[model samples]
Target: MTTSPSLLAAQDLHVAFPGRHGAASARAVDGVELDIGAGEIVALVGESGCGKTTLARALLGLVPPTRGRVVFRGEPLTYSSRALKAYRRRVQLILQDPTGSLNPRHTVYDAVAEGLRIHGYGGDERAAVAEALSRAGLRPPERFLLRYPHELSGGQRQRVVIAGALVLEPELLVADEPVASLDASVRGEILALLLRLRADLGLSALVVTHDLGLAWNIADRVAVMYLGRIVETGAVEQVLTAPRHPYTQALLSVLPEAPGDPVVLTGEPPDPSRIPSGCRFHARCQILAGGEAERVGVADACRSEDPEVLGGGGEAQVACHWARAGITA
Candidate 1:
């Protein structure tokens, strides 16, 4: 979508965990297809337990998919320790909690330099760490070099974690709710920092988030996940501002800035281990439950047929019986 080379992609991916006593496996990531273009930012958004984080793990090769493959720069991941080790150098992760990610005993320099050491970087470690720190917005990197995680504020700790990832010169970053732990003021700063990093470093990213508002602020494109599958995807403006899927519409409607009163969804998402028959979302779909799909003559289909999996292309796509039929009522 950014007219850049495709950097990272997942094709028909699935990651499932076996249940106790041979129960149905928990399909944490099921039949997902997504792509992040070079220098492009794509947000993977969904509520907790919908498998967004699991998908990120699979993409980073932290969790091997039960099926399908992850393609980086056009090559499928081999999952061999040697290949994965090399692959990690080009793709890094930034976790949600900086305090948890950084060792309290280790100074900022050691923390940021850890990746370089692990990767066996041959260049000047100090210079690389300094540049990474500076790039993460910690000015005068020397000032923070010796400071431990306990000495820094929440925002500074986050920058240090970012610096750690940057030290590897990674081409892609899989950031899971990178700003969810920051204060309101600091949140904007971190988001801006990510944007700046993208512009300056030509970095690509698959940002995992539950906040649609954050996606609107920082992403070039969006993939909305539900029940371990992508229900909708497109350019950010198209997907976030004008969502087409009923699940996506419900997600967006609950945002504080949305014009209408929030559409309160009924019941928790069905367990991943036993996903519903037909449309996985049909039992709780507001549109179908509200009689719109029935009026449009697709409610029966919604209850008996699974929608097609999204192809992860640039074109806006929604996996909905009524939507695909152009019969929104």
Candidate 2:
């Protein structure tokens, strides 16, 4: 199969914020290189505090990168007011918490119409709102137009949040745990909705999620993040079923269907301000725990040299000393 042209690319992106009380700044996103192709859904998966959300914000132009740049449709994304306004219209952010994202005071119609008003949509605002609502699965849009956030169920509230983004007619969407706040039953519905939208609208999405299952359900590609960097990235089946990186292997080992005992990783991720010298995951790596790296003869490199994400976006790529050489246990 052929690869589509990338609609958004993050090249060596890094985002840092000042630490508590004059301490050194903490790097939330460090050296994240990722690409989201046109009409593709790329899931950014990892545990909490792994920089997935920060990367999403940087992509949306909501947070400026400390170092590196984000490219959109072959152009370097800019933060100028005019440029930002245009970018915001083309790239929408679907927040995790629908209840929190929506204005409690605004009615459903008002919430979805806000983007239209901001973007100067002069043509039939009412029809635009109705269409957006319908696209988001809130059918008979007029029936929900007068409802408020508290009046709707959790699932319906999230749909309104989606309708708000859909109203902008964005070509790309950055959804941060879009279904995390919904019920299990609603989760499948939301995921199905995303798949349908992708097929129907040719919309591209960068979804930040902690659920591996979600990636399996909807993402065309999966990029596994750890501590601020992608440890592995590839087609969803490739990365999830045959992960090359030790971290990826350990992560997949814990899946419910994974046979035998889980390979539990020890040690917490290093502080971003004090990330280790070489492999960021070496300290907690299962493969390197009991002299396995020595057996593989890659201990020296794993301890002293940082490995860049290898492979030029082929079917799969991993950033690890052993992974590149097929040395995982």
Candidate 3:
């Protein structure tokens, strides 16, 4: 909630993919500014193709930003192989699909020890792996050491994946859809495990998910992304319980068992390469569609002005013409 980034941050970040065959470049992450405080969990929520995953990859230094920069511990992230190699040890990635993340041939012990071996960890490998597995909720860690990926259940495999990251003893975990592949029950278990890990290890996390309910339950703050930018961000309760942006409101409106009829905005988000001139969301905005912006005398601004979100921590903020006009649909 502070004004500065205490851990990892993306400042004016932009990652673009040059199109081929005379096509325009696709700006996957156009201009993102986000921060994660030490030991705090922040959820990046958006629909598919919203650049959430691209942003995560940039934060991990896997993909270098074309325009902006990533910062860690108040220092700008360096992309050199030597710097990245060292950086990866302190920041680990937890992939979405546990089944594909693990090597079927690798034993649990081998999978967990791979990082230690890669980093040339001189300490006791067995003890470290055991401790990591134990911390990841695999009790009596020795019991699963020799088991193969095929031998373990879905939940257990995910725990192994989490153990792989924990083995490195990272300060931050960037998890991309950590529970999306599991069943409802397993999802709850995984969420609970993440919370437990945070409490036990003082670890910070950046969780990329489309589920606002998951964010509401697990994250201290929620950042709502659309297209390639964050449109709203603040404390989870403040944003989820009372979303200010039209996009965030539409996202929450479609949740299961949520009150009122869903706000069905027609058409998908604009292409990243051909982002509109005005508000990128104006084409599909419910407020604009319902004439609320016109009645409030901000329709022109909604159609011509692209307001930047208020970021870099502190109080809740939103980037929308109607909201800025002190109006809500």
Q: Could you say which candidate leads in lDDT?
A: 1
Tens digit of lDDT per residue, candidate 1, span 1-329? 45677799999999999999989999999899888888999999999999999999999999999999999989999988899999999999999999999988899999999999988999999999999999999999999999999999999999999999999999999999999999999999999999999999999888999999999999999999999999999999988777888889999998887888888889999999998888999988999988899988899889999998999666788899988878542
Candidate 2 per-residue lDDT over residues 108-210, each given as its tens digit: 9999999999999989999999999999999999999999999999989999989999988899999999999999989999999999999999999989998
Write the number of the candidate with greater lDDT, choosing between 2 and 3: 3
Residue 234 in model 1: lDDT: 92
Residue 86 lDDT, candidate 1, scale 0-100: 97
lDDT of 3 by residue, 1-329 (tens): 54435798889999999988989999999898888998899999999999999999999999999998999998899888899989999999999999999999999999999999999999999999999999999999999999999999899999999999999999999999999999888999999999999998889999999999899889998999998989999889889888889999999999997799999989988888898977888999999999888998989988888887557574688889898888754
User: How high is the lDDT of residue 198 in model 1?
Assistant: 95
Give the candidate order by descending TM-score: 1, 3, 2
TM-score against truth, every candidate: 0.98, 0.96, 0.98
- Give the lDDT of residue 207 in candidate 2: 90
Candidates 2 and 3, the one with greater TM-score: 3
Tell me how far the alpha carbon of residue 212 in candidate 1 is from the true structure, in angstroms, after superposition. 0.6
Model 3 segments more than 4 A misplaced: 2-5
Better of 1 and 3 by lDDT: 1
lDDT of each: 0.92, 0.88, 0.91
**Candidate 3: RMSD to truth:** 1.1
